[model samples]
Target: MAHPTTSVLCTELGFEWPDGTTVLDGFHLAVGPGRTGLIGLNGSGKSTLLRLMAGELTPTSGTVRIGGELGYLPQGVTFDTARQVDEALGIRAAREALHAIEAGDTDERHFTAVGDDWDVEERARAVLDRLGLERLGLDRTTGELSGGEAVLLHLAALLLRRPDVLLLDEPTNNLDRRARSLLYEAVASWPGVLVVVSHDRELLQHVDQIADLRDGAVTWYGGNFAEYERTVAAQQETAERLVRAAEGDVQRQKRDLAEARVKLDRSASYGKKRAVTRNDPKVFSGKLKRQAQETAGRVRGMHTERLTEAKERLTAAEDAVRDDAEIRIDLPRTAVPAGRTVLHLDHVRLPYGPRADLELRGAERVALVGRNGSGKTTLLRAVAGELTPVEGEISTPVPLRYLPQRLDLLDDTLSVVGNVKRYAPAVGDNAVRARLARFQFRGGRADQLAGTLSGGERFRAALAALLLADPPPQLLMLDEPTNNLDLASVRQLTQALAGYQGALIVASHDLPFLRGLGITRWLELDGTLREVDPM
Candidate 1:
């Protein structure tokens, strides 16, 4: 069946703060009944516009019209600790209400009399099956569920509400590859109007259209992420050409104004001498002065107009290249030769409850691929010397750098540059500033408190500190490095890893990223670590 006409229209929308500061201005958008991917840099008003569409925030100056009911999933979910998966889905309440209505015991004042025919249990089951939670134990506590499982459960609950439109913000942050694939599949088949705010390039490829938000305005494109990128590149080139042309025009205008001023000065000098003389020999001195003044005024006006035009063109060009500078950072350099044995594990056994053992090694770029709490991070910790082996001796080399899944090594109170200096004291201030510049931390940003930095910025700072040590690490260990990174940063990091010569042991569910980095070995963690042939 065709989907309903669920759309949103925002006309001349303007949102401001209490201090009379405008964040979004003259923003016009038309959201049709299809998948629309919203793309922007951080703090670009994507989240705010989504909330406005969901009716959570009213626009300060314009109207937002929603054609139908809307379902929203914010960047994070707040779970009720006391509620189970099923109870959170409202399945129990729906069941009881249906039962009461069918048994003719429901309050007539509370429920409409459309009662006994409703198949609430069957409907709930259908929705659960569609969401891949049909076989799950509904009474399982929310606290016990893994990150991906909890996300799927909450999504199921939201789908059960049957809203005409759905809005999701960064919905794939903690999802593994399997979970992400499942989500994309579900959203692809969903029959409602969907607006997604995300920086994941792969996810954006699945949408029908892209709405790029930049400079407080939205520009629509009729294709996926790849097409959008190509269009933006072309636009940047055009803007650069315009900037050059404007500069040339300004230079020409300046030359013309100078020549005109000289001519006017000569004319006035001659006219003044003629007026002072007793013999009125000039044909028309008054006309000559008036004409010189008009010419100078016109030249001045042209100069002002050319300068304004040049500045406007320069601003456009700068904005076009602003987002391109972020993906240029160099990864930590490692001089360790390739194919060297950085670490080895023999007969290693890690216990899980009572009867399981997990083994891992540094011989492969192993992806601890499984649901959360499946000993992936635990295995990495063991290799990093953060956790001791319970039975066998785990061999590891000295001068190894381990980037934990969480940036716990960074001191929150210290500035970014201060943290780097403290961690690697031998690095000079100038060298540290230069390295920070590669990571897009120039000017006063390096002096900002580490706690105030965003997740991506913190990750960059931590990586900078790790790589800038006196002697570079011979082995590199990273856990979920791509978790909070935007797509461009991930690409840049992957390229840098491809060039690194050190031994690598990464624990990530990002399959595409691993493949791009030329990971050649695989270790599956079941009860033991057994090497498998590379894919």
Candidate 2:
């Protein structure tokens, strides 16, 4: 039996995909009441662990125990569009039962169904209001709500359950500034055990501690994301210093071994000369020679052992240092000269978003931010020519490319190399592969199918295709590009964008990423597009 206070406990937990890919082996985790930020790289099994904890998946080998009722909000909050918001909130039955009794049905079943949840509807409504979804009435169909609204609705349903344990995966992926703020408030006040797997720094700021899932294990860090960063930075600095010291030790060992060998050879030569000059008897001379040979062999063995130990230490030291690869590519063709007209929007009105006029010239980098359901994605689609504007003139003097939030640019059947080739048909296979290597899709990785890729790998492939397109995008637009990406991958993306010389527009809620882009302009979409201070 698990401890009474332990909200969740997994003992000797292990899981493997049907295809024989092992995710976790002998993994043991115990989480108590409080918010824990579960962080890791995209393919590091954070979602898998959450699924196991939520009972959505059965482990191949061990047991999971929960001390209380559990609620889970998946990364993708999917439901039938025809379902009512009340049904989606898991309160339809109780609400119906209460209404029937109010209407004098006089059925014992209604009373039984209502139980102690007579105020279920009110509680649900309050949760919705807290999550900024009060406008979304219970009578509304799920289809009427946007993606962000669906996510919040799912969270509201979970909150209504009021479980002792709550697990949320990428909860803030599609949320905008205001929605995220609302979520932050909810997380702050969560009394039960909460484990959230996310890359959103703001959301992570509310965590009581960070559980970094790396290399199939959990390493706990006290405090929130900022403190975790500081701790890891300090650790890396120490690891690097150890690596340097170990390297020096290895070099010294090598030199000492070489010198020992030279001295042994010289000593043997001198012994041979001395024996020949002394003209000792054959038996005595041969015995002395054998002894000298044995001594030399022992000396050589000792030096070799010392060298091997030094090399082993060096290897361990190097392993301690993080070698996360970065994307570094030079695209001279993507550059847009100063005063060049990249994009122009003449009184453009988005379908459900904003009505605005804008002109982007030269290599200006723009950050587009807004509240959820404010139509940031809609405006990007309109600019990308995916959607017809309500009424306006939009012109692009140079070639452009848009990376949507869904990342549907690549054909699932094609490999990463093939996808890039499809975009840049004129480029040779070898040339494409060479460029993709810079994006960390090296060798066999470049040959993997797009459908088989993890979220981060797929993002990288899509980004590579867009940037390496035939004409090279002079006006590049991205919608929530950092979603599903790990912190390291986010840094890699930031580095890649740093090398871009074209006019760039990114619609994202990631303040740190936007700030890192050296954004020359900041625009907010409400009812209209307006300039905001560079944040």
Candidate 3:
């Protein structure tokens, strides 16, 4: 069904940070009923756009209009620990009023509060159940839930609202496979307008359309993520062909202009010789020379204009081609011998999971997969020495580093280069910069503050720091590394990893990325770790 004209509309919208960094300018968008996947590179204002539509942010210029009530789910969900589940769902007052009426306390205030939501409790429970939160009673505190559970609970609240328009930003970043599936089911059945900004390919597959945000403009494509990819591939092919044609045109124009100049020179020479041989009157010769010069001027002007237009066309065609750089580096120091044992775990018991044992050797790559609320993060933390195991032993004989999902390892006050220096204090400034260049942080970008970097840039900086530490990590543990990365950046990361000769353990829900890693083993972490062929 077609939504109202104002379901979610932005007219000449613009936004800029306090530091005068423009996120969006003169942006115009109108979304109707159906799912739309808003995708863009990191720092391209996907999240900012969602905030503007949800009224969490005011645009610097223009306007945002919503025809009906709107619901928003941000990347992170924060709430008071003591708040009850019903309160978070926004049905506490109505539920309380209904309870009072049931208890025979027919106060006028209670009757007024109950109003039209007499079944608010039942609806809230239904939403919770749909999101796999059936065990979470209305009395449960927010603090009792895990990170993934908290995100799901917030989404459940939004679902209960039944808004005319809903906005979700990176909704599946914290979710596991099961939680993601539940969310996808909910999205597929959404009755109102839905807009999602995410990097999760699986979630994007459920979208009815793709809205690609690039260079401050939105390009709409009809169909799911797969269809969008096919369309973009075809467009890129056409663009490359156009670029080749434009290049040929410019070359031809240059040749024509050169030939025209030569011809004019020859014509002028011939006229001069003929004038001398015929001994024409001085006035007639002068007029002939002036006329020849004017004709030459017009010819040159016409050729120059054609050449200029051809060059302009070439530039436009080149602009249509994307040139996103990839990460390429050699990490010879990170290599380990085939028989080297990087990590060994003997009946390790984590805080919330069962005992597990593991032995990693050489440059083996392992993928850790599990559902939400599982102890995947916990296990990685224990190995990284961030958390203490309840029982048994864990050992890492060589240098190790962990890149957590939050990416809080780097100091915000330091520059990108400075952060790397912090990790590899012995490396010289010039050497550090040369190494960072491989991560795509060159020149002034290396000097930029960590706090000011975008999501993708920050991830690159963190990876550089870890891989280039004082004693290069032989065992690198990454948690959801592709969470906020654009497709181009993800490819860059995969290419970078191809050069790392170390034992790698990555915990992620991104199947495509794991498949690209050439994983030697896949371990599913439920209560215990077990080998599984997820592929």
Candidate 4:
């Protein structure tokens, strides 16, 4: 059971843009203890609402109340290039406090300020161990750590603060399978209030409740993402039925108004004829005209009311069930000769800077599965011709598209359109625009700077460029293509790949994703690459 004190409440909150356009209105959310997942499509005010909860943004008209201390881990953290993990963990502060105590300078002021008298090194080591960084060198520069490692370190630091309420935004974005599992385990065991925003279906399944943000309001559900999805489907069906019924009512009302208008017209013509006859004709005509006018007014009022109600019903139905179009890649057609081996490695081995062979592989849809720094990415790069082989003959087709795990191919300085045009000139502007639209970029967004785009947007941009290239490659190599992608986008990519007729070598720990794609074979990269049967 959750404690009553550990709760978050929002009341009739609203937000508007600088142009007086509403982004979120009449919003209310109640988050109780236990893990709650926040979900929505991009630009649906999920982030804005999170900021409001964290007290980083003020609501325009309503109040947000958090019952306890709040701690937040933003979507991504900025690491100090010069600092190491130990430095980031406040080892210096710990050391200073320790030294003061050891020097027999334990004044009340110093002791109160320091808070502890334990060895700083031991404390730091303990914290690092809990975060799975015990073996990592304290002196290692932060700049040298991989993106995934950096994220873990930042998370460890945040946990050290021991906040009562933890707000995490896409915490699993760059994490590998092992790291993600560790994070899930930690959150599950935590006793504080947790509000997380993520699109990973697997991660979301662990949450206690799902708060779906759509059309500027939050809908609460009692189960995981799958349950929420089912609920949404049912609600959408009901809304569609209501909308259709409303339309029928509107049509019926229109017909009734038309009939009434016809009756009034007939009555007027009858009165006009009597007025043309003689004696007391004016009085009779006036009475007939007054009755006609009254009928007309009633008919008009009823018609207006019916139309307004119908329109409102339709709008409500549309709002209840917004369409999320899965992103589909329009891969350029290419001629890949059948039975022509696209990639072959004969007794190939991966060496770590003059060390013995670390991993070996053969031709297959080999999933390099391991923890971070397990050399999965290195193997992919070696196959892609980016890294030279140390001891074997590696052969691949001339044009292979390699999507790195971290989308490093994008030029940060270039605009989205510029990058596409430069890398894939054969794709004309119109075609490029169409492809971008499939990925949900439209209007001026297609022209925005790539550096300014969000993680999801950047992934879409990279995929767009890959598909637009002239002479599409026969072999598609991807390292964790599902990372940071929303569920809908992942489905889109999976569907596109399902229809693709090419060799694919992907390294991802997303077991469900790999199975969903129906990968033909598996290559396990542990010490030596060996073919393993898929589970």
Q: Which candidate's TM-score is highest?
A: 2
Q: What is the lDDT of residue 354 in candidate 1?
A: 13
Those runs of model 3 whose alpha carbons end farther than 4 Å from true positions after fitting are 1-4, 264-292
Clashing pairs in 1: none
Per-residue CA lDDT of candidate 4, range 1-535, in tens? Answer: 2237547888889876554556678887778788899987666777667788888877788878888788877765668789876677656565666678779977676566566635557666666677677777766778766567777787777677667888888787667777888788777777888988887887788888998787777778988888988987898899888878877877877787788778877877876776777545566768967887887788778777877777787777666666777766545364355556677776676756321222222223445555566667787788788887677777775467889967988887887877878778767888777767876778888887786665667887887777666667667788988766666667777876754556777788788788887777777666666667884
lDDT of candidates 1 onward, in order: 0.71, 0.90, 0.91, 0.73
What is the lDDT, from 0 to 100, of the residue 419 in candidate 4?
A: 80
Clash count list over all predictions: 0, 0, 0, 0
Model 2 vs. true fold: TM? 0.95
The runs of at least 3 residues in candidate 2 whose Cα sits more than 4 Å from the true structure, single-residue gaps closed, are none
Residue runs of model 1 more than 4 Å from their true location after superposition? 1-32, 48-68, 76-83, 95-128, 240-323, 327-333, 337-341, 351-374, 385-393, 404-414, 418-422, 425-431, 449-455, 469-473, 495-501, 526-535
Q: Write model 3 residue lDDT over 126-197, tens digit each, in one string.
A: 989899999999978887776789889999988878888999988888787788899999999998889998
Residues 172-266 of candidate 1 have per-residue lDDT tens digits of 76676667877888778878889998767778888999997878888899888899889878987887787787778667777776776787678
Cα error of candidate 1 at position 237, Å: 4.4
lDDT of 2 by residue, 8-109 (tens): 898999998765668899999999989999998877788889999988999999999988899998875777999999999988888888889999998999
